[model samples]
Target: MAEQTQPADMSRWPLVIAGGFFLIMLAIFVVAFIVLSGEDTGMDADDITETAYMDIVTPLLVDADPERGREHFQRYGCTACHGNQNLAPAVDVMIASAGERRPPMQAVAYIYESIIYPGAFVVPGYQNNMPRTYSDTIDEAHLGDLIAFLSGVEAEPAPEIPEDDPLSIETPSGDDATDADEEFALSADGNVILTPALIREYEDLAEFLLAGANPERGPELVIEYGCSVCHGDLAAGILAAGYAEMGQMAAERRPPLSAAAYLYEAIIYPRRNTVEGWDDNMPDDYAEMISTVDLGDIIAYLLTYADE
Candidate 1:
């Protein structure tokens, strides 16, 4: 067979073209990487703020201000259910009976959890009709105050509800398997072991925290913790429809950062990364004011409507 020689120049052209294309893609990748991971810049040396690192410590100490707590107990409407009427056990009753279960006689801890996550335990013969919104309505500190007030100062007696009142029915005993109260079992130590129910609730909370953030709780924290004091009025905040738009805006303003990341940074280190057109008035004391779990929940709630 006569050898039909291929041209060397034509064969080399393919390699050259591929090399050029590869270089172009590599350059683009480099640019995107730099853009996405860039640190806070464009501010003067003193103007730069550090990230607000949260410590995963045991929740805030229960050294509650009893007087302040008492005010909070009544102001937040604890009197409505827990008054002398026995609709819900009175503050003194819960305190006096605090050691009746296996759980440690941490009266403050018990009352604090009750106010924040009320569904975890119900006093025997008491209904679990307590509102779960207190977590949303009150901050951890104020709740601690409430616990202090309930632990030290007795609550005023509730006026008995009339027979016709829908709320007058007594809560079923824990031995009643048909009622949800059965889950609240007493511990061997003669104290209430809220661990089982609490464990279940925490498992659900773990899933919620891992499944993105709790944007629903975010806005509420923002208000309860007074975040809007600096972030303009996030009271009405943004709706779901505005999330994508807000994300895009956050990306553009933040440059290569996702809106979620930006939001997280804004909370943890408000002064670290300042948004253009906004003042550097964000408080840096959030690490002390908000717990890590509460911070996560708040972020999750905010992201629900303003996520990346």
Candidate 2:
């Protein structure tokens, strides 16, 4: 019999099979990372302690007033993320959980720890998205009042500030009444004390951003905002930078930051810096169009795609 003819491509079959297997493994890894990392875990209950926040809490306890704290709660926008807002545990739920975790845990101490070190014991099933700025932005006594209300503890009445105080609305005298613009002071602590007019303006702007970035509704946002046009569908390529080819292209730039940080800087400061191949034509008005809270939601939405 004539010698069996051999095809030239036959020798390449092994290499092709090995390549196919390697790709399958890579895909499995990517999927596994996404699934596992998406499950948020809070700080262990054992680690949360009353002493950690005692320095700040001790001062407030002397004059803690639950009623006064309730007002501060709304002023600082704590309602924006907790309870019915569904971003974090509701006030009642959090207190209840604290009670369960450490049966002997004092309500005041638990509330204090939560406000000062939110990340210390993330209520199970809640994201650790609570801002850590409360300790600084809220005076210790005011914070105590808030804790007092949340923990159902009775507190003293907060001292009243005079209505005519600079932080208060002032009667316009002379030609200033017709000026229509009230004096606005930017608090040194970065909290904006909005005048009624400014508050209306803020509400208008917030409405324009579609009730802020609904991170849970991020997929649609990517399309609505046309993010995919420049960055590609982030959901489609979660690890875009991890590819070998991308590493070579990004050799000169600093290592990429967290998805939240990068997206935030990109939106607020479009001209500040940009990705390697993209143009800087992103509308400069987004800073004025969206609230910082909304920007954070967008970042949170985008972070869902992060491989990490």
Candidate 3:
């Protein structure tokens, strides 16, 4: 028998296979073009989104003015707790001790901290009462201006005493002894009062204290100084030791030493002006143990919260 011959219809099979292959290749090319284009466009879209986000989030730096800050102080109620023109005021009425000497720069530093981290150092009696006023309400530039104004303030002069006339002198002794009293008065005038010398000493101490005061070192000193013992941990407003008697104390008794500036003074001059009720508890001899510079550091550390 002869071999079977192939059918003629088989001639179209190769053409059908070639057509199918061409269609598949075209489909793959289309997919590749779409995927590449999408990736490139996606990157461009992401770049635009990132730029817009940065513009919204970045904060702008501005120059601060102390004069404006002083105005802000009055407008913002700082004097409510501190005082008005007379730096010294009645201690019990939310103000600090009268006649207490504090450096202007140190006060500025304190103001800065109080504004940022208001709760960090709660003036003993005023804890929880001190408002949380900084974070988002005021920006950095305004805070700096407030600091500038506080630092620029200088202490006012003391009033002068008048010479006494003989008639004005009160005699504790009922019997009159004019000649003897005159000699005693002359001797009193002749003796030099060491007040000027004492003032000079205090000035020197302040200089020493300020030399090492930096905000960076404040937190450590807070704990080291035993402030945490009474002001609560991290100054979050918990009364530690000796806080219970704050109310019984006179207005001058526990006048809010929780502010960074007030705290600095409380530590440096513990007995300078006793807080009415808590006077017995506070240490009176800081001069022997801590330096002025260390006190400044404590002030700096406390200021960390002014913006908090």
Candidate 4:
């Protein structure tokens, strides 16, 4: 009775089942690759996006005084590895050349990663001598500020002098050249002495930092701005670095600017309000020195490690 009941299409069933199984296996491999690659395995797309988002948002919450941030760079011994003012012969000579392969703007991200997780990406030319991690030495807030400052530095451009200007070629032996140099250093309002080229460079750097190509650069810029001096090594909170009383007072009196929006206002209009214990006199020139883009980068960096 069973032999008589065999169906005409029975042979096709096995092939169909086999094909379906193969398809399922293929689909699983595809999904696995996507999941694995998208993960934050040291440096993945999600990690980069999170970094970019933080760079754009964190600075708005915290105030980062560029001048103070600059001092932080020195205090933390960052200059030992990065370089002095010019940023030419970087203290970490090996990394410097490696960074050169990419645009100085792109280099900011690498610098940021180096600060937070030094071993993540060992530049081929550089010795893996960077501190393994700054988890202890620097806090999240200050780290953001540092990233902001470094991004700003790389963004700075060479001073430009119009070839057509009569004063462009003045000899140093004469008063004209000296006068021109002096004038070039002064800002339009005469409050700051940054050169036009420097200003342009800062603007470019700020723009690059905000673009999200390198989220790590934002934190590096914060360091460059010198915020660490008053705000401590990582801007975790000023109190631990001798501003404890002031930090407490500021916390109570102020409206609480510990995120991106607040930080932006603080940077752009530092003297807008005084926190409880803190002085109402934060540097006014931050408005003049830092561009909107750099401020965004600082904000982004802060979000990565800022305390809840």
Steric collisions counted per model: 20, 4, 23, 49
Residue 10, model 3: lDDT of 80
TM for every model, in the order presented, reads 0.32, 0.36, 0.26, 0.29
Segments in model 1 whose C-alpha atoms lie over 4 Å from true places: 1-59, 153-308
The sequence of per-residue lDDT tens digits that candidate 1 reaches over residues 20-64 is: 999999999999888766654434444322211011012443455
Off by over 4 Å in 4: 1-62, 83-108, 153-308
lDDT for model 1, on a 0 to 1 scale? 0.50
Please give, for residues 1-308, the per-residue lDDT of candidate 2 as tens digits: 22236565886788899999999999999999887775543234554455644555667878887766665664444543452335566666654555465446567777777777777667777677666655655656667778777776643333232322222322223331221243445455322343566445434543444344566765555444434433443212331232222223332332233334335545654433445443233433355445456565665565554533
Order candidates by TM-score, high to low: 2, 1, 4, 3
Select the stronger candidate by TM-score from 3 and 4: 4
lDDT of predicted model 3? 0.43
lDDT values of the candidates?
Answer: 0.50, 0.51, 0.43, 0.47
Q: Cα deviation of 227 in candidate 1 (Å)? A: 24
* Model 4, span 1-308: residue lDDT tens: 77458785885788899999999999999999889876638455445543563574366226644334444554354543344223223533433343453343254455566566666666555556555436555655556656555545433332222222312222223221212243333334322343456445444544544566343665466556645434545333432222232333332332333343334444554433334343332433455345656666665565444432
Clashing pairs for model 2 are 65-155, 69-145, 69-146, 83-90
> Candidate 2: TM-score?
0.36
| Best-to-worst lDDT order | 2, 1, 4, 3
Model 2 residue 149 distance off true place after TM-score fit, in angstroms: 1.2
Instruction: State, as a TM-score between 0 and 1, how close model 1 is to the true structure.
Output: 0.32
> By the TM-score metric, which is better: model 1 or model 4?
1
Q: Judged by lDDT relative to the true structure, which candidate is superior, 3 or 4?
A: 4
